[model samples]
Target: MLEEQLLQRSENKCELCQSGETLKLYAVPPQSANNVDNCIIVCDTCLSQIEKNKETEKNHWRCLTTSMWSELAAVQVVSWRMLNRLSTEGWAVDNLDMMYLDDETLAWAKAAAEDENDEIIEIHKDCNGSPLLAGDSIVLTKSLDVKGSTLNAKLGTVVKNIRLVENNTDQIEGKIEGQVIVILTKYVRKQG
Candidate 1:
């Protein structure tokens, strides 16, 4: 199986930190298929941090200084990506400057990085800076007068199952007073 192959290739240790505890396979992002070239063995700590399931420990990633030079393209790509994520640190910046990747590997790393950045940039937030998703309930923080009509959307109004306006982060659509109206995001707060 792929797990066995990865264990053998990684020498039964985490490829990034060389840890022998609780190791498992980690498929690199923007993955097209599962294979030795697209996966690496990682410990629970590394996996959790990489997946953002746990807080990142900057010192724990210092192992990248050595792993960045692995012969495997998968390892190199992950190392490069991690270094970029920790680029604010002087050591990580130095390591990134020293790391090298072939044209194809560099492209793969950049493609996945860009996808992550795009997702971060597209999130919609409410007046209090809380992230808003489709079908979420929100409360109007300020009363708004509907244009071209007599709709009075009063303050502290609860709008349920709101739909985010497509391609527009500044607005959401909700039914207030039995009429569907576009609401400004800055005037709403996400409801628990």
Candidate 2:
């Protein structure tokens, strides 16, 4: 399978940070086919930051200083993109200055950049500022009074398998007392 090939290519380590934990295949953007040339193996941390599921940590990405020199075009393109994303940092800028990409690979990297610029991503977050995803469990930070119902959604209540409201980052849906209700995201905290 494709995953086996990527793991072999990456030596069972994350192609970005060389972390050998929870590795997964990541398809480089702007490419339609899933192949070794367009995909790289990355760890959960790298994958989370890459997909914007978590905030980017500058210290963690210092690995790009070495990964940018990879012979594979996919790894090079990803390193280039991450450098550009973190260009505000002096270290990232320095790395970008030294990194080079071929014309076609540069074009591919820029294509994803343009698409990123054109899209507006809405991420739902908990009261503690942690990103919330569908099927995540949350704890009520404040008690809520259900209108026209006797459901007691008290503080410290645990709501499991919550769903993010479509087109609305400020709200999520969860069941309480056998009834589903929309809860404001600010009143909840994501549970581990």
Candidate 3:
């Protein structure tokens, strides 16, 4: 219901980039409410980059300058978040200076970054420096002994469907011999 409303409100285009491709409902975080006021329509590119599931193209987010002035709170929140993420860029810094939000919305906009040290969203990567995401297959490049078990994960072991360890960029969880264990990302390479 809320998604339908957002879709109509956005004219079936991505509210941020105005792209009419592969739209999805992106709920503004820290609220988790499924209402129109807290959700915006986004394209696949925006969603993947926002979640750090893929590398962000800094140039792609230049649209924030226009979206920042949206009357919808959800759009403003996402715009503020993206602008903050790109704050190191000169244009982003200038737009952030010009953007304004009321006290309550400003607090909500800062919630995600406030607790993060350095305000940078961490990206998980494999030994080769390729970005890693949940459910990606990986091959162990070095042998590792399970800390509390007799199992020794051998070199060249294929660990299928790995889960990224949130809050830590250097580790991932995968099952070795039916035992789910944390593996250091440096010891594995993303499998094709």
Give the TM-score of each candidate: 0.61, 0.61, 0.60
**Model 1 lDDT tens row, 1-192:** 999999999899999999999999999988879998999999999999888789889999999999999999989988888887776566876687678899999998888888777232344679976767788999999999998889989999999999989889899999998999999999999998
User: Which residue pairs collide, candidate 3?
Assistant: none
List candidate 3 stretches off by more than 4 Å: 115-192
What does each candidate score in C-alpha RMSD?
Answer: 10.9, 12.7, 12.4
Query: Which window of 10 residues has the lowest lDDT sum in candidate 3?
Result: 113-122
Candidate 2, residues 106-187: lDDT per residue as tens digits? 8888889787772324467789767788999999999998878987799999999999898999999999988999999999
Best-first order by lDDT: 2, 1, 3
lDDT of 2: 0.89
Candidate 2 stretches greater than 4 Å from native:
118-192
For candidate 1, give the lDDT: 0.88
Query: Ten residues in a row with the worst lDDT in model 2?
Result: 116-125
Kindly report the root-mean-square deviation of model 2 from the true structure over all alpha carbons. 12.7
Over 30-92, each residue of candidate 3 has an lDDT whose tens digit, in order, gives 775579888889999999998888987999999998999999987898888888787657687
